[model samples]
Target: MPHVEKAVKDWQQQFAGLKTSAANLMQIAFPPLEIMQSPTGCCETRLHWQDQDSEASGYVCIDDFVQATLQFENVPHSVAGQALDEVFGLGWFNGAELGVRQAGEGVYYWTDETNAAEWEVSVLPGGLANLSIEYTNAPDIATLLDALHTAYEDPHEDDAAT
Candidate 1:
């Protein structure tokens, strides 16, 4: 287990920028997503919510800031793929499926220009394996915003510039 905070502050901090970025990039307008605490030791310490429209949603279950289990959905395969990077700090390469370089036996990875983050993957036979890399260490992010910025050139576009 890496580490993950059982809090929603991260989402709160990025929601506005995420919303704007999604709008600019995806061209699909969605109101703010109110990430709600899904209080549970009974289930999992997590935060959950649905995006304002599109039934698309994401949830982060960070029992103790040790690590997180994240998931989101959208109609498009590409858009859905983008979520792992945008909604979660995990997509360093932004386009790994386009191509991935072998890192080791049965393993491949994609890295951002700064090497700040990477999507370490185990392309197991039929995609079944348990190779894990701590994707939560990312912050300045090709891992953070690339998915949301997939369509926009200026991924780091300041909200004030809008």
Candidate 2:
């Protein structure tokens, strides 16, 4: 297997624009490996973390990152089909519909099928366009942010003399 630590760092570099510091990125499990595949084909990755908020009632905190069917069936296939294949790969069908939801203190990427990829780009709570790219492997959230930021940043350099 590739060096997971390096991979995580690489991902961080790719998404530095999101302002995701190494400290914040290190808080979550790295290279979210798949733990199990249910009979229905749903996959789940377990993230283990210690709740820093001592005031909370819970002791150990475990977050389940689940991937199911896509949630947005109403979205035309024509829009998602080619894009999905190009970004993910061939043979990986759109298992779940794509949709967004606020879960706990953060947002999660969800699908309607047991196995599928979801892509969503929207303005986040802070007014930054949050672009999410999710796949079977670790979703490169940082890379997406960096790319989006670079794409949208004002290109014109201040040249008052011109």
Candidate 3:
């Protein structure tokens, strides 16, 4: 009816849609299938995860958070350090209060998932980034580090499902 009302309605609908998506993902992740969505949302629409290739790491999850199988491989930790620095500086973590840690001389890690947008991600290390992040505290410190360590340890066996 009014401009302000229309904007509010639109925003509400968008939030509702996100909720529905989260519910759907929860159903798939923890219920009849227990499979997760790829960063691409490929298996999510089908209610099952596609067969994962060996590229880095693996993951297990619930609606709230994910647990990664940390075993990284074939990573140029030195190079990745710079790459990740650039990544963290771009998004919410850019000026956020959350802390980013250096796992080693060339490896970095951030345990904060506070600013992850639903269905937002560009790259996944150890399949640790969520495709649809609904909870601010998803993948707490230990779990995130596990995945990071795993992915870096055996980068070939990891997949993007977190």
Which portions of model 3 miss their true places by more than 4 Å? 32-110, 113-134, 137-162
Model 1 lDDT per residue over 41-133, tens place = 422333444545555454433323323333333322333333333443333443443332211124444554443334444433321222223
Q: Model 1 — TM-score against the truth?
A: 0.34
The lDDT values for all models are: 0.36, 0.29, 0.34
Candidates sorted by lDDT, best first:
1, 3, 2
Clash counts per candidate, in order, are 8, 21, 24
- Models 1 onward score TM values of 0.34, 0.22, 0.25
lDDT of 3 by residue, 1-162 (tens): 699999999987786565446444444333322334466232222233222343323232333123122222333432233233334432333332221222322222234444542222223344232222223422332233334344444453232122
Q: Model 2 over residues 1-162: C-alpha lDDT tens digits?
A: 479989999976665533233213323422221223233232222222221332111011112332211122221122223233234343332232331211111233344254354654332333222324344223343232233223223222231111
Q: Is candidate 2 or candidate 3 better by TM-score?
A: 3
Instruction: Write down the worst ten-residue block by lDDT for model 1.
Output: 153-162
Model 1, residue 3: what's the lDDT?
A: 34
Q: How many backbone clashes does candidate 1 have?
A: 8
| Inter-residue clash pairs, candidate 1 | 2-66, 3-65, 3-66, 3-67, 4-65, 4-66, 4-67, 5-65
In TM-score terms, candidate 3 sits at: 0.25
Q: Distance from true position, residue 118, model 3, in Å?
A: 18
